[model samples]
Target chain A: MTRTTYRWAALFLALPLAVYIAFVVFPLLSSFYYSLTDWNGFDVNYNFVGLANFEKMFSDRLFSNAIGNTLIWTVAAIIVPTGGGLALALVLHERGIFANIYKSMFYLPIALALAVIGQIWLWIYQPNWGLINATLRNIGLENLAQAWLAKPQFALLAVILAWSWQQTALSMVIFLAGLTAIPQELIEAAHIDGANYFQRVRRVIVPLLAPASVVVIALAVINSLKSFDVLYVMTRGGPFHSSDNLAMFMYNESFQKYNMGYGSAIAVVLFLITLAVIAVYFRQSAQVERLYD
Target chain B: MTKTIAHNDRRAATASLASDRAQSSRVPMIIFYVLLTIIVLMYSAPSIGVLLASLKSTAEIAEVGVWAIPRSFELTNYVEAWNGGNAGIYIRNSFFVTIPATIISISLGVLAGYTLSKLKFRGSNALFIFFVAGLFFPPQIALIPLFRLFNDLGLYDTLWSLILIHIAFGIPICTLILKNFFAAVPTAIREAAIIDGANEWQILTRLMLPLSLPALAVLTTLQFTWIWNDFLWPVILIRSDEMRTVMVGLASLKGQYSVAYGVQSAMAVYASIPTLLVFVFFQRYFIRGLTFGSVKG
Candidate 1:
């Protein structure tokens, strides 16, 4: 690149990079600094407290519960969306006419805001008038109906189900793309060998879909880590904070309780976990790309 | 004659076998449609149920199951939800936050993406990786600090805070998408333009920008949906009721109208309309944007 080209590049890149650094990088690094302090987000004078917040976090029951719930959420996010999406994609991949309609229906939830979906599910889970219990009672299964979002055992699961509904469409679309890329001759050869539908799917289709699965699973994990809005709107991580994930825990601690130092510590932990996940994702995806090549 | 007879028998056997395969496939085909219908219904029930609930009166919503249609369609529920109190204000605020945020982010992204992909300056690859890494940084990690930063800047409790934060966070994905898009544009075009004495600016504006309309459209739609549907930033940044975006407004609206299911549902439906329209109109581009970001990135 010539000097003039270099100058031009600098001019073009300067503003956006500056804004990004100011808002994104600077704040992120400062959060790391803040996590080591006793700053409560208010006073000017506070002593540096090293690892004290981390120690407190380890002993905190809510924090541990948040971690546990996050793990459950991540696992659920992977299995439910990937499994449901793969099934739907397989079924819809061969059915062209109705595939459009089905895809639209499945993807509709993704278009809705998390807050709106949270509200919708809140109403659906309403004990008396919500759809679930109402249907259960209408079918003479009143004994089975319970407050879906109110119970500790059910709250996290309920939130996960709603999240999975939104997520399945994403996985399905990715899988559909993957399924499309699979060679038709291979499936035909399997059929010529008299492999039944189940055998074909299990042996041929699912194995070929491993790359897509890697992408879907990575996205699901990252998404589960950031799960907050729905839990905030639906249960507020309530019924004794059973559904509070790391994000919500961070929010409540930092903003609601003004524990800036502790919140920053939690944020750092979440960020590291996210970074690790993304690292694995990139590594696996690189291998997948190599295989394709 | 015997050889001909053997060939005919073999043909009949293969024909029978083909027919049997077809016959067996019919059953699974039936089961496939049945399963597809069930899944579709399950997926669409929430949206449909909410829409139906939005059309019912509060009394009807309470007295009957959401599955039941109202005795009369209360279209006024939408009007009430919009014009009644702060829903209209919230909707307007969302537009205020979304449109400008989308435009600014896309513009900055295009410039940076072009420079990185086409210009090939020193450290450009490193810079691109830096931006890409931003994608993995969970927003929650930055919340408290950004909250404090915005407060220090006196941008808190205002739409600018939300807009700026959205633009900042939106840069990573937008730049990634556009960088890839610009890279795919034939370098020969750039070479020809350079030979014609066209500078980087003219080439980008005249040649690249025009060619990148499809990519720009995808980025715009995706970013619009993202900023429009955002809840976390606005809830934390904009404390004033009038300044609140629709998502936060809808949350508070739920609190106030907890018993008014029809009205709340109407607001929820209203909040979803813009993105839903984008989805309906640009489903292909939207899905492409989504899959491209994940699958390729």
Candidate 2:
């Protein structure tokens, strides 16, 4: 390819590049710099504490709670969406109007904002007249019904279920796309070789859909770890910080409690974790592209 | 190369229904229907529950629960949400934020993407990396400083701040997707245009943009949903209720109408409609955009 010469390229990229660098790049780097300082949210004068902000985390219960909850979130992200998506994808793998309709039905949840999903789920989990409680009562399990979000024990799980509903739809769509890419000949051959449907799925379909599964799992981890919307709407990491993931905890600390430095530290920790995941995501996605391409 | 197969897949989907039905056994077909029926009901239940609740009286909702069939089909709940509930203002605010943000970001991304993909320029790779790096980490890392920056720039608590932020951050995915799409166009076609006395601006606008309408549609639909559905940025950046986006408005409705389940569901339905409408009408483009990076990934 020939170089398109000096001024034209510069002219073309100038505006977008300027805005992007000013907003996204500058703030991201500044966050790392600020993570070392003891700057309260409104303070102009602040001291640099190096790793001291990071060091205080060992004794911080809320930090531990956020981390543990984030871990639970990450683990759930890996399992639920991936498994459910793969299952749905397999069930709806056939080509037809029926498949398309069901596919869209599953995909519908992903189209809604997490805030809306949170509201819907919040109603479902409401104690007195909520769907879960009402259904539980109807089935003769009145004792099982309780305030899902008000109690610390069930809040995170409730939020995760709400989140997973959307995520599963995403995973299903990805898996369906992956299933589409797999050559029909292979599955046909497995059937011709006397393999049953389940056997064909186990030996042919699942293994062949590996690339899609990688994307699904990676996205689950990424979206879950980075999640703030649903939690913010539903619990705000609340009813005693039980539902707080890193992002929510960081928000409460930085925005509400005014622990900007400590919050920035948490943001850094989150960045580091996400960086590792993104790195893996890029590698796996690239490898998947190569394998599929 | 992949596009050909994708095209064939679409064709196959529309034409292969009879063959697909023939290949499967009666038992498996029954299982598929049963499974699909159960899953469809399960999947649609939440929204249906909310929809039903939105049509019922608050007293009826309290008496019958969200799951129970409603006796009252009240439009009063919707009327309340639209007028008294501030959903009307929030919907207007959302449209203001989403439409401009989506259009401007995609336009700028088109410019930057064309340069990055089609031209050999110094620092192009670095520029590409600069934008894409925005996608690697959570936005929380940038929030505190952006919070300060927006305040300093006096863009805080307004639609402008949210719009500007969406555009700026949107560059990453926009460039990533559009550049890859543009890169697939035969370089010879661009060279031919250049040889025919066309300038860069003319070629970009006349040749590239027109050719890439499908790509633009995919990008537009996705960005619209993302910008419209955005909650976190608006929640933190805007303080005033008048400036609130639909999401923040919906959240506030929860706090204000804690016992008014019908009102809350109505607001929830309002918040969901724009994105849901996009999905309904542009299902192909919506799915294409959602699966774009994943399949590419």
Candidate 3:
């Protein structure tokens, strides 16, 4: 290609590159800079309070709870959904009947906007006449029923259950793909060696499908950490801020409370934590990168 | 060889297989059906319950158990909700913000992705890595600076502000996904186009863009779904009721009508319809698209 053509291609490239740098890259750097100062969001008269916001973050009770809940949310988001999804996928795949119906049903919640899900579950978690508690009581398990999103102990867990149901469909899809890729010969071989279905799954299927499992788990964890909509809607990080994740805390501090610096500090910490986990996950899955293609 | 193994076990295997078939068929099918039904109930309960409640009067909604049949099917709840809720305006606001954001983000993403994958430019790897790292950075961190940035630029409270934010945040991951897609395109085609004395612009426009239709379609749907459902940026950036996106509008509605369950449920269902239609249309490709943006080549 001559210089003229090369210049045209570069011109095409320049438009997106300029936008990317201005919006994404610029804001990120500015946020980092703002984390060092005490700027009330709307104020014009603010000075750099070096390390003060960071100091407050270290000692803040809500920040600590947010971090702890964020960790729990991440773990439960990965574990609970992953187990349920794989189990569902295994059952649906073996049956090969009503699979499409099941898949569509499972995926319904994911398609709904997060606000809608939050609103739907808010009613479902209503303590007195809510379906969950009422159903338990109807079954003569009255003691088992609880105020799901109201109490501090069960608030995050209840939200996680809702999220797990919504998210697991994607995991199931990934698992189904991985399951299809596994050579059917291996499963037949295991069956010939006097293995039952359970044994074949354990011995032949799980190990071969480890990559898909990792991808699902990693994605779930990241998504859980980034979750804001439901928590923002249902609880607003309330009942003593027990439901507060890092994302919510950041929003409240920066926007609601008007503490931009402290909020930026919290946001930075959350970013570091996410990056660390992803880094570790990638390192562990190095041998399988070949399979990604 | 595979057929011979089955042949060797003809008699004993036939008995065993018959027993296996009988046992597995009757028991597991029932168990599977039960389990699947339970799961379906779990998933569909809230949505169905909400829809039913929305159709019921406030009194009936309050009196009946969530799963119970409504005493009467009343359309007033939906009619009143739409009028009082200003949902039509909110829906329009969402379209205003979502459409431009989706187009700009996808277009920018495709360009950045195409350049990085197809063209041998200086610092492409570095730029791509930067974008990948952008994925890991929580949007919370940037909210403050962005708010200030938008305010200073006098772009606050408008759909354009939200569109810019969405495009900016979306590009990194979108570009990452598009880069992988462009990489997967056969280089031989490019070489063939080059041999025919076609310049990069003509070749990319006439050749690459046409062949890359599947990726373009997938990216468009993904971006459309994402922008339509976005909550945080719109919520923070657009504070006025008139400028509010549907998510924020729903949030405001929820707060206002916390006691009015029927009205709120009706509104929730209203906001849910557009995304539901998109999901139904792209149901086959939804899973692939979701995984494609986040995962590897």
Off by over 4 Å in 1: B1-24, B293-297
Score residue B212 of candidate 2 by CA lDDT: 95
Per-residue lDDT of B1-297 in model 2, one digit per residue for the tens?
899997787667545744765776678877869878987898889988888989999888767776777886888889999988998999999999999999999998898899899885767888788777787678888989899899888999999999999999899989988888899999999889989999889999999999999899999889999999888899889999999999999999866788888898898888998888988998888888777755533
Higher-ranked by DockQ: 2 or 3: 2
Off by over 4 Å in 2: A1-4, A286-293, B1-24
Per-prediction share of native contacts kept: 0.74, 0.77, 0.61
Q: What's the CA error at residue B87 for candidate 2, in Å?
A: 1.4
Error of 3 at B172 (Å): 2.3
DockQ, ranked from best to worst: 1, 2, 3
Question: iRMSD (Å) of candidate 1?
Answer: 2.3
Query: Which model scores highest in TM-score?
Result: 1
Supply the TM-score for candidate 3: 0.93
Compose the digit string of candidate 3's lDDT tens values, residues B1-297: 978876676556556866888886997777868888897877788889888888888777777755577878888878877899888898899998788888888888877787788875677798788776777666776778888889999999888888898888888777887888889899888889888988777877788788777777777777777788888888888878989888788889966777778888788878888888888897766667765633333
Least well predicted 10-residue stretch by lDDT in candidate 2 chain B: B13-22
Write down the worst ten-residue block by lDDT for model 1 chain B.
B288-297
lDDT of candidate model 2 versus the reference: 0.87
Any runs in candidate 3 off by more than 4 Å, and if so which?
A1-9, A290-293, B1-24, B293-297
Candidate 2 CAPRI classification by DockQ: medium
| Span of 10 residues, lowest total lDDT, candidate 1 chain A | A184-193
